[model samples]
Target: MTAPAPSEKALVPFVSVENMMRLVHHIGIERVLTELTDVIEADFRRWELFDKTPRVASHSREGVIELMPTSDGEIYSFKYVNGHPKNMAEGLQTVTAFGLLADVSTGYPVLLTEMTLLTALRTAATSAMAARHLAPKGATTMAMIGNGAQAEFQALAMKAVLGITHVRLFDIDPKATEKTRRNLEGSGLTVMACETSQAAIEGAQIITTCTADKQYATILTDNMVGAGVHINAIGGDCPGKTELHRDILSRAETFVEYPPQTRIEGEIQQMAPDYPVTELWQVVTGQAAGRRDEKQITLFDSVGFAIEDFSALRYVRDRVRGTAFFQSVDLIADPDDPRDLFGMLQRAKD
Candidate 1:
């Protein structure tokens, strides 16, 4: 006898924002970050095996909406994210997102989740992982240039992955820095609130910029960045939006997630179209050099990629096994007869 196909109710597991946060808390944020780092790094190590494509974007005067998709031959994942820098002024999140993971065998979704928080987690984790390879040895301090919603997450990720013991924060808005400082209180790190970006970078071996503006803006100048510092430019993640000065870009050995996407959306966009930049996955897999010398300046031009989101979804999928953090949703229709979908729908009217 032929076995029954999977039921619709058993197909897709949905993790709402509440449940996503619950799963995060259940696993503890730091542990989740660490595990996510591992999972993301694993994917990067096998980077050649997954499908890669630039995110599809629709631009508007206010912001842009994007869909990033990828497949690993066996599973597929996609994320829907929006970047509206002015949203905070209107009491909305600057970045909001959701994602789905599906099986390649049946093209059926296996998991769906709120990826706003997961994106923040994965971005930080990806940065910390890069720093682990590219930052100066014994790096103990990080200069956080934009202390917005992502600041605290970056701080914790750096602490967990790279052993950063202090974070010096400077934002254009002092209130944001203050908010980050308060949020990070008693997190086992000496948090310094600085008045200027120059002051924030002093003695810092790692510099992270996460500003949210859609124009070509220099949050850091060449003169401010000394040698042997790893700059994680998370903020310069869209066309016409950047955080580092062109002079700094000219000086640093820049690394990036996906060169094609970064060429349009990263600080590297400010450089020559043919500008040479190393892919971070090469360093992750030891195919390329990272931090070649103590005096060499290195930069991670991080424009979030689809594979990282895929890895995050994969992590959540694995973590929720045999757990109640996810609730199955009736997202698909399953009929007793494969060709009776219409009949099933008709029966539901009874």
Candidate 2:
């Protein structure tokens, strides 16, 4: 027996992974990244308006699962995401996610979408946006250490948003580096695969680290980092998973999305609780300084904040409207009578 479709009020737009890929192809990936960067930056400029809180996390021996929630008073957004570093060994993704946006007025969901791909896009865009303010002027080369699923997106975002012309790629696994290099074929940027992390960052002005390790491991030593470089360290998004050495952080001027959250999950977790750091939002709004001198070493310790996910959801919602890129799902229950839930259930069996 076929069931009748739900009412219009019950339908919510849902963007599947396939549809998300289609939408990305339709709008063009570079354009999407650029637009997302702008949207996230605009949201950061108005950061004071948003309700901010640390993501609720459930930690395990394997990895972490989290619910990141935030709202701008009008629209509320939340993401359900998981990170398991060992999943790759078991032929699964290290990170996977989905998110929802709801209208605060009526508490009904407006949009639901897969966020695994969108997260990569937004994280890369956020990195590029921070580099725009913190990286050295006319920076061209970026050393991408830990070339994994996020490697290509980070490279393309830097290319599209910051005009980076070269990417030096290195990974602990040679195959991973090759994968990134091959995916970037004809991307118009020079791709160089290096044997060592040190070789990768040789002449690069911007260095990004995104490894999928679930422990305290140092991917970048203090001596490996040099002056006048922007370090986008995004791998350390949990309690003990950090990439850079503590000495490196001591010498660098670290910027973060939210101090309270960053202290719990970002690279700066290695530092003291009272360690002085600038907020990226403040830098975006010109309330704080970024890259004060040529010799400055700037670090963006990104732990993937909720507001960033909010902005990404907001961007997707606006783009998917009235398009074939999303399908309507009956996410809400709409009874013929507003107060007749039992009656509606009783009628369902007929």
Candidate 3:
């Protein structure tokens, strides 16, 4: 019997976590942060150009897993992220993520990358992007409420985008704070470890809350907040997880990435339906105002939108090409005969 001919396959690029780190290293984290901020801001300004959706989440006894999908008419991107607050005790990150970028025209994946690190980068970039328009002018000091893997990225992005030179850190775990400080060394920012949340926020122009708790924990109380402060609330990004007191949200002029999603996931989740919040895209596009007065309290309730990940994948795809590090894998099969779906089974059996 004649052997079956070799099957044809389409080559797709696969980027591992190590390759992604090398790519970021080669491009320089500061440059990547700047470029990602630009990409996300541009995407936000033209918000009507893309297809958007809230992430689909699967809940388990331990935590939750989520799939966030979005498309820009040309490129499609989605991220798979799991939030297991218990994972840290197992020597794992509280969140582990991966994502794909595909050609919308062909419905074929062009790149697959580990998003664990990318998530941290884009989250920080998004926060800084929002702060650029919402934070007070000449903001110099920032308070980081939670020191985890994301803490250093927030510090770097704020320093690069907002000219923040002083970072005050606080975390439930002293080791987490130490890790943040060590990672931020030589970044030209002064790092201070604070004893409590209030100590961290004292005299800070921008306050970022990126805790990993999966419940309603008030990391920032209304009393601790002062006037003219921009709050980047990043941790309370799901239902049942809230960092700011309801009164703090009621008192401040709040801005969010996507109002509908933020209503369910951000600190505003604790507020009434008509609590009155501004969309960050509107502020970026100049369709609405940001920080109306110098003394007005501004809050950016960030839930990590799909558009930001879309922009991040696009940026990485553009930069990783022509580099020697990426490997090609066949994630999808391309049969020469489109009707040969059953043939795949026969070949496997043979």
Q: What digit string (tens of lDDT, one per residue) describes model 1 on residues 167-274?
A: 999999999999999999989989999999999999999999999987878899989999889999998478888888889988899999999999988888877899
Off by over 4 Å in 2: 1-4
Candidate 3 regions with alpha-carbon error over 4 angstroms: 1-9, 341-350
For candidate 2, what is the TM-score?
A: 0.98
What lDDT would candidate 2 get against the real structure? 0.94
Q: Residue 197 in candidate 3 has what lDDT?
A: 90
Ranking by TM-score: 2, 1, 3
User: In model 3, where is the ten-residue run with the lowest total lDDT?
Assistant: 1-10
TM-score of 3: 0.94
- Greater-TM-score candidate between 1 and 2: 2
- Backbone clash pairs in model 1 (N, Cα, C under 3 Å; residues 3+ apart or in different chains), count: 0
TM-score for each prediction? 0.97, 0.98, 0.94
Please tell me which predicted candidate would have the highest lDDT against the true structure: 2
| CA-lDDT, candidates in order | 0.91, 0.94, 0.88
What is candidate 2's lDDT per residue for 289-350, written digit by digit as tens? 99999999999999889999999999999999989999999989998888987777777776
Q: Pick the candidate with the highest TM-score.
A: 2
How many clashes show up per model? Answer: 0, 0, 0
